[model samples]
Target: MKIAFPYMGTSHIAFKMLIRDLGHEPMVPPKLSKKTLTYGTQHSPEFACLPFKILLGSYLEAIEQGAELIITSGGSGPCRAGYYGVLHQKILQDLGYDTKIIVMESPYRNPFDFLGKIKSVISCSGVSWWTFIKVFYKAWEKLKLLDETEFLSHQIRPFECLRGETTKVFKECLNVIDESQTTEQIREARKLTQELLNNISQDHTRKVLKIGIIGEIYVVLEPFANHDLEVTLGEMGVLTHRSIYLSDWTRESTGYESKKNIIKAASPYINELFGGHGIYSVGHTVLYSQKGFDGVVQLAPFTCIPEIVAKTILAKVSNDFAIPVLTVFLDEQTGKAGLQTRLEAFVDLLGQKRAIQEGVVT
Candidate 1:
C-alpha cells in the first residue's frame, strides 16, 4: 500500500526511509510553497492553525499523486494536533477523496498506544517484527544524522569565510541524506557530509551575534514555514540557535525521555502545560536568557492558542531577565521583505546592546 504523511522539516527524511524500508511506497507531499498554502487554505476552516491548513494542502497533493493510505501524527492535549487526523479525514471525504487515514496516537500521550498503532498499521501491510525494528532504527539514525548536520550548519554559517557556502554544503548533505535508500548508503553519505561541513572554512576571529529561537515546533523546525528565518539571520551574520528540535521530540514521542525538557525548567515561570509547545516556548526563553543569548525570537502562526498564551508569559520573562524577545507570526500572506526588515533591526539592536555591554561602542 502506498502511504503519505505531512512534511515536518527533516523528520520526513527519516520517516520516508522507514516506509520505504518496510516495502511500502512513501509518497511525500511536495514541499510547502505558495501554491500548497493556497490549496490548503482554500479548503480549510478559516480559523485553523497554519500547520493544519498546510497538512490539508499536503494531503491533497499527495493523494493526487496516488497515496492511498494517510499516516498522520496525533496528540492528546488542548492542542488541536490531537484532532488533526479526524478533521483531515473528514475534510478529504467532503472533497470526495476516498483515501484512508490512520491516526497514530502521539507517543507523548501513551507509549503503548503509539506502539500498538504502529504494530497495527504495519501488521496490515504484512511487515515482520524484525523488519519493523530494523527499519525503525535506520529511520532514527537518519534523523540523528540530519539534526547533527543541521547543528553544524548553524554553527558554521555565521563564521564561514564565504557567505552562503555553508548553506550550499549543508543543502548537499541534506539532499544526500534524504535520497539514501540503504543504511550503509546513509552512513557513508553522513560521513562524507560531515567531512565536507568540517572543511568549510570559518573565520574564528569574526564576531557574530548569537540569537535563540524558541517557538511552535512546526514553525521552528520547518524552514519554509518560518520564512527561512534562521538562514536569513545567519546570512546577516547572526548565529541562530533553536531550543526545540525534531530528533529530541521524536525520542520523547516514541516513549523515550527527551534529554532536555524546557517545560520542567520553565515550571518556576509557568506551572501548567497549556498544551503544544506553549510550555517549552516559555522555558526556552528563560533558558536562552541563562545561556547569555543576545536575543530570542519566537515564531508562531496567527491564532495559535498555546503560543498566544506563551507570548503573554514571555513578556514577563523578558522584563525579568532583561532579554529582548521578538515574536513573529506566520500566515499565508506573510511577506518576506517585512520580515527581513524587522530581523535586520533586531540584529542591529542586539549588536548595539552587546557592544554597550563590552564597552566597545560606548
Candidate 2:
C-alpha cells in the first residue's frame, strides 16, 4: 500500500522510516505551509480546530501524490482526537476521495487492543523480528535526537552572541538530520548538531528571561502552526522550554504511562484528567512557576476544549502563583503582526515583573 500520514513536527520522519520497515511505500505529507493551510481550511468545517484542518489539507495533498492509505496516531479521550480518523475518513468520502484511513488509535482502556493494533501494523511478511527491532529503534532514536537538538537550540538561541546564527545552525542541523540514512549517520548528525550549536558564541552574563511553553501538543510541537513561537521567544531574548516532546509521548505509548511524574507534580492544581494533555498543561504551568520561570505561555488550536479548559484554570494558577500566563489560539487566520505585538507586550510585562522582584528598577 502507498501509505501516508500527516506531519506532526519531526515525527513524520520517524513514521516514514517505520512504514518502510513495515513493508509499505510511505507517502510523507509536505511540510505544513500556507498552501497546506489553505487546502485544509477550504474543506474543513469552519468550527473545526486548526489541526483538523491542517491535517485534512495534508491528507488531500498526499492522496493527490498517489497515497492510497492514511496512517494516523489516535487517542481515546474526551478530546476529539480519538474520533478524528473516522470523522476524517467520512469527510474524505463526502469530498469524493476514496483513500483508505488506517488509524493507529490509542485505546488507553485496553492494553490488548492497543497491542493488537500495533501488531497488525507491524506484521509484515519476510521481515524478521531482529530486522523489525533494528528499524524501529533506529527511527525511535532519531526522534529523541531530533527532540534533543530542538530543546538545546531553544535554550542557547536566546543567549547566542550572534543574532540569527543559532537558528541558522539549528535549521541546517535539521536538514543534515533528515539526510541521515543509517544509524552511524544519525549518530554523527547528533554530534555535528551539538558541535555546531555549541560554536554559536553565547553571552551567559546577560539577564535572559526564561519562559515555559505549555499547550495542546500539536500547536506546541509544530512551530509553523504556532508561528514559530519558540524562535520568536528566543529572538526576544527569552529562553523557551517545551512542556512535551514527541519522544516523551512515544515513551508513554510503549505502556509506561510516562506522564506519572507530571501528573503527580500537577496534582495540587489539577487532580483529574480531562483527556488530551490538559492535565499535563496544568501541571507543567505549576511546575514552571515553582522552577522560577519568568512566565508561561499556552498555545492551543481554535476551539480545542481541553486547552480552553486549561486556559481557564490557568487564571487561578496565575493569580495564586504570581506568574503571568499568555494564551494564544492559532488558526489559518491568525495574524502574525498581532501575534508578535502581543508577544512583545507579554515579554515587556514579564520584564517589568522581573525588575520589581529583583530590584532592578522600582
Scored by lDDT, the top model is 1
Per residue, candidate 1 scores C-alpha lDDT tens digits across 131-183 of: 89888888888998999889889988999899999989998998899888788
Q: Which stretches of candidate 1 lie over 4 Å from their true place?
A: 108-112, 258-261
Worst 10 residues of 1 by lDDT: 254-263
Q: Model 2 over residues 107-143: C-alpha lDDT tens digits?
A: 5667676667656666644566677778889998889
Give each model's clash number: 0, 0
Maximum-TM-score candidate: 1
Give per-model TM-scores: 0.95, 0.94
In candidate 2, what residue range of length 10 has the lowest lDDT sum? 117-126
Q: What is the lDDT of residue 140 in candidate 2?
A: 88
